[model samples]
Target: MARIGVLLMAYGTPRSLEDVEAYYTHIRGGRPPSPERVAELQERYRRIGGRSPLFEITLRQAQALEARLARLALGHSFRIRVGMKHSPPFIDEAVAGLLEEGIERLVAIALAPHYSRMSVGAYHAAVREALARRSAALPVAEIRGWGSHPLFVIAVAERLKEALEDLPRQETMVIFTAHSLPARLREEGDPYETELLDSARRVARVLGLDHWRFAYQSASATGEPWLGPDLLEVLEAIARQGEARHVVVCPIGFLADHLEILYDLDVEAREAAEGWGLSFRRTRSLNDDPLLIETLMALVSEALAD
Candidate 1:
């Protein structure tokens, strides 16, 4: 029997001041996001208790996924582990855990659905780098991107339905948002923006919603151009359309509650909505949702079968 190793990966957050500078530098590709910039980013973490729950949340995500896999009964013996791109309980630690459990083959999956060169792609690189460090070439399988997954589409639709249930539905604009990437990425043929749009379109279609738009959020205004029209701009546009008392932002791209969802949408966007006299509501993240785990189980079953 071939042992199957299951891995969940995420873009990690620093746990302490010791990690602040190094983490910032790695993300900036050795150029550094600037000490001031890094300090600003750190304060966001500070505001939320001086540490991020990303690593913790991802660990629970792995736990839930593994439990679901067991219930779903994937015949191959396997162990599930969580790995972070830039922190301890790192990729190599997870890989080592799998090896300890005698998992001979691996299936690497990102908690994120879309494949951006900066996001999911980075996790893939981490796996390869870890393998190189170990002098081992494990037979690996990967799920490139699952934004178009039928279950994911349905999940978004359900989330949107729940939020729109009480809101005065007349002329309420729907804006689906994801984290933004640099403009150069699209010019270089990156599909980040395209993938997000496709997912949003499918989710909207599933809901039979015609009044919908897509926007990018949490973009940096640093010298380089980033993906847009930004969420605030879109919100303002909808407000300007008149009689727009309500706007719903479905975070169709993200699967959990992180900084972008917390500060970006809940804080910054909410402030903008109030300024424009528009009611604001965002779909709750599908954190450890049972159905979400079912979808992951199905995804795992699909990959292992092939």
Candidate 2:
């Protein structure tokens, strides 16, 4: 009998303000942050209720996915777990737990819809390291990118439609956004940007949207050039044009509400939009959206079939 393990992975968040430094260190790849830098990071978490619900939301996702799978009655033993990249229940820990559950096969996917070497690639590396450290050579598979999954596009389009219902469609410009990555990925020929654009385009087509554009958001302060024109930059430009009365930002890259959605989009970006005298509203995050769960289940089934 073959038991399967389905692991859901996310970027992770600190449990509380006090854990921000440790989380920051993990994100920096173990480079300890300066005191000032730590304070700045801590403040961001503080603004978002002094904590992030990323892990909790991901746990709910895992639980929901498990129940859905059980309903399918696949007649195979299966278990689901949530893992984080920069917090407790790290990827290695999740993998170890799956092994302990006697799962002979693994199916994994990141909460991120798109892929970047800096993102999904890092996740793959973490899984490999975890497996190697445990001396476990198990069959594992993953869906590196599901940005163009039909259900995913439909889910996004539905959300966009719901957000635009009260606004004059022609007077609004839909801005599809995703977390920014380093500009170097372009020179390195990473497929991340292209995939992101593809997802945005598909969702727009589904909605039959005419006035829409894609922009990057939440760039890191890594002292390197990042993908842009940023959401704020785009909003400022749109305000200058005086064409659209409202700007709706749909974060196609993120699937859940976290610091990025709460602070980056709602707080920071909203402030920028206000400065430009432009109306700003972000689409509700796809946290536990039934369609999103179905999308994940499809990915798991695809991995298991292979």
The number of the candidate with the highest lDDT is 2
Clashes by residue pair, model 1: none
Taken over the whole model, the C-alpha lDDT of each candidate is 0.82, 0.90
| Cα distance off (Å), candidate 2, residue 191 | 0.8
The residue-level lDDT of candidate 2 at 274 comes to 84
Clash count (model 2, backbone only)? 0
Could you estimate the TM-score for every candidate?
0.92, 0.98
Across residues 1-306, which tens digit of lDDT does each residue of candidate 2 receive?
579999899999999888988888888889989999989978888888898888888998998899888887776778898889999899999999999999998988888989898999888888889989999998889779899999999999999999999999989999999999999999999999999999999998898899998899989888999999898889988999886989999999999999989999999999998888888998998899889989888888877777
Candidate 2's C-alpha runs over 4 A off are none
Would you give me the overall lDDT of model 2? 0.90
Clashes of each: 0, 0
TM-score of 2: 0.98
